[model samples]
Target: MKRDLGRGGIVVHPYRGYGSRQEVFVMGRVFRQAALGRAIPHHGVLRDVADVVRRIARHGVAGVRVEASLGANRTTATTDRDGFFDIHLPLQTPLPQGLSWHQAELQVSQGDDRMHCHAEVYIPPPETDLLVISDIDDTVMYTGVADRLRMLYRLFVQKAHQRTAFPGVAALYRALHVGADGEARRPILYVSRGPWSIYEMLEAFFQLNCIPVGPILFLREWGLSWRRPWPRRAEDHKHDLITRMLTMMEDLPCVLIGDSGQHDPEVYTRIVKEHPGRVKAIYIRRVDRRPDRERAIERLREEIAHSDCELVLAADSAAMAAHAHAKGLIAQHDLVEVHQACVDEG
Candidate 1:
């Protein structure tokens, strides 16, 4: 569920979190009059530019105290220098059966001012078979990440709805989330190399396109400064996140989805090699046309051939869906919907 800003200037913006039955981890930020409100439908390039500026200019309130409670379990933490608070609350009692989504009450205070909000937590049921982890940039949406200038233009000037998703992606993700039986409620987690400033834009993009909203792990603020000019390597960031997810959910196998652009192939290949049998499949979208890149990915595919995971480089979402159906990751009827979505989106 989405939370609204409180009356005070202070706001607690909580991202979706996932955890096991024994413990729940939730994270959010405390900001002063800098809440990125819901992305409403709007028009004009100037408005889009203004929206991006507003997002970038927002500042966090550092050192604020944050308290989180899930039922009787409670924990407290102070915000980091970036005003981000991460809380790990141990569960005295296991979560109720059959409930996939749970809410945790969050309150942030600095001096006499305080603000309250709810954080959503996702815990996959025991019956879930596969955990889906996907990349956002070129995998799900059309952000020309390989071309820096074009990517920046699209990122800074496009509204949520104006930004387009690849054909049939929504249906494919939906099918993956529901599983073959159409009864399992599997979690679909997304990871991005983008910074936290664009969080609201991505959230609105998921809601607008009907994609399942999961915990989106994003990078921290990056800019040209005296302290640090360059951002961390994208490969390192994504690799760390995937490994953390695998460690957190040790029982469930994972389906890795990414694009040919950048280091997804290398990063995912490393994950497959390091965690053998844990990754069921690796789906790479063919976003780049370079032959050398294709050959490199092919070598990676062959390298992982000994493992149980299959590396699939697909030209379109329909191809991925077909492979998933054959592997029983998605239902047979869902394939039809994916094909129709391709045609409709085209």
Candidate 2:
């Protein structure tokens, strides 16, 4: 996808997509840039605020037609009121072997204006051992999500490179992506309660921090509009997305990762109960040290103890990595790297 934005033209922002061998799911937004606007500065506090405002103030092009094609398979979709289009294209035949990433051509047109971009679709190789789903906010980075004011302040004032990821997170995730054999090539998907407005920033953060990127799924914008007076519950949104992912890749069991700052523990526990043999393990970062929260999570841990899945409440990435290594989810050498990364980051 193109990084630089040009003025006064139609632009399609295609996100990374994921799918099984038989079908692909992709989504993107279309925007018509204004012809007259000064180039925003890219430094200092005021510039960061301006950039945040610009990203949230985007006006989507509604009713525009979007066409996506992969090989001989083709599909068309129209943008919704929010200028977002989702395409689910079924492959004419299974994708070729030994190739995990495939490029799909995306074209958006309305009247005389047309724009084109290429989206990458990922399909886990047959050697994959399991799927990994993780929450983004407190689990992967230091977002201060438990404190709304601090989170909002940092969200608007900090650039992507300025954001801080937890120590050893990159190494742990990389180890999970390449499972115990060191060649498993597992797919790692991230989910967030954040709106789509910050998609670019999060993408840049992943690149800057060396986090393995897969399909990043986020909720829609939230406000006090008449159509949506209140945002959807975080647990429900995350639960639905995880369910969809598990259904899409039914052959593989998965490992779930999240933080205890919010509803991750509860949501993941519900998933474990609902999908009995499908969950290999659950890792919850101990972001909230409240006694009540700890006791609640302990009860949940015991509830799922009878099943194969183990709920581990870890204090940091190193703790999680150690458990994962013992469970044969990651390689032994990867655990050493994660421990060293923790020391180096500290």
Going through the candidates in the order shown, the clash numbers are 0, 0
**Model 1 C-alpha lDDT per residue in residues 1-346, reported as the tens digit of each score:** 2233322255568888788778878888876554343463355655465567655555678899988898788989898877788898889977778898999998878899777789889988888888999999999999997776777667666768789999999999999999999987888889877777677788999999999888887754554344653455555878888898888888689999999988989999999888878999999999998999999999999998889899999999999999999999999999999989999997
Top-lDDT candidate index: 2
The CA lDDT at 293 in model 1 is: 94
- For model 2, how does the per-residue alpha-carbon lDDT over 1-346 read when each residue is reduced to its tens digit? 5433435556678988999887899999886554324665545665565666566556778999999998778999999887889999998866678998899998888888677888989998877779999999998988998777788766656778889999999999999998888888889999877767678889999999999988888855543245764455555878888998999997689999999899888999999999999998999999999999999999999999999999999989999999999999999899999999988985
Off by over 4 Å in 2: 1-9, 33-36, 39-46, 223-232
TM-score, each model? 0.91, 0.93
What CA RMSD would candidate 2 show?
A: 2.2
Clashing pairs in 1: none
- Cand. 1 Cα-lDDT: 0.83
